[model samples]
Target: MMLYPSIMKLMEKTGSRYSLVIATAKRAREIEAAAQETKNVDGARSISKAATEIADGTVVVFDADDADSADEVFED
Candidate 1:
């Protein structure tokens, strides 16, 4: 049912579908963990939120060379 971000839009940010999936999943997990700690669940689901973040440029996929700093790409 999700449609705002659009797959093509997300793919444009991420070079490929595989990369997109990886980035989204990782962000979703982070979102879920944070929600658990704060006991808050009033926003979009983690998967959708992660996709939205990619579309909005709040998160990005880093190249292997930058793997060491990959965790820093996500911003609140």
Candidate 2:
């Protein structure tokens, strides 16, 4: 993924209060490693599980296949 200035801007705007969960099965380790390099974002492997309990309201940002899994997480 191309690094974008707007993403950093959004993170700065939100501050450390929000959790940033990256939902990727294969790249979980890499994602976590990269997230560690970032100063204040909390990273996790499971998007569905993490989304339900984010300190702030969750933002589910993922690729197409993972989007379908959100229904399972958010359904009543």
Candidate 3:
């Protein structure tokens, strides 16, 4: 239930609440892992960092049904 307004925008982009949750949770876990492995991480909490990443378009979320679409949305 990370209900930041900015994060709501990301939810709209993903077109599914479940997808947004998955993305945010995954990013939060990464942030936590990074904190464990290093210091000087700018002092942002993992949940906040996750929301900011979504709001800033630094991360993209895709629905489970959209596997093919994911490739296009996330081109290398």
Off by over 4 Å in 3: 1-7, 72-76
Clashing pairs for predicted structure model 3, backbone only: none
lDDT of 3 by residue, 17-74 (tens): 7777788889999999988898647876897888788777787766778889888766
Estimate, for each residue in 1-76, the C-alpha lDDT of model 1 and write its tens digit.
8878999999999888989999999999999999999999986799999999999998877767776677564441
In TM-score terms, candidate 2 sits at 0.22
Better structure of 1 and 3 per TM-score: 1
Q: Which stretches of candidate 1 lie over 4 Å from their true place?
A: 65-76
Q: Which residue runs of candidate 2 sit more than 4 Å off their true CA positions?
A: 1-57
As a whole number from 0 to 100, the lDDT of residue 58 in candidate 3 is 83
lDDT of 1: 0.88
Angstrom error at residue 71, model 1 = 10
Q: State the lDDT at 67 in candidate 2.
A: 59
Best by lDDT: 1
lDDT (CA) per prediction: 0.88, 0.41, 0.78
lDDT at 57, model 3: 74
Query: Which RMSD does model 3 reach against the true structure?
Result: 2.7
Identify the candidate with maximal TM-score. 1
Candidate numbers sorted by lDDT from highest down: 1, 3, 2
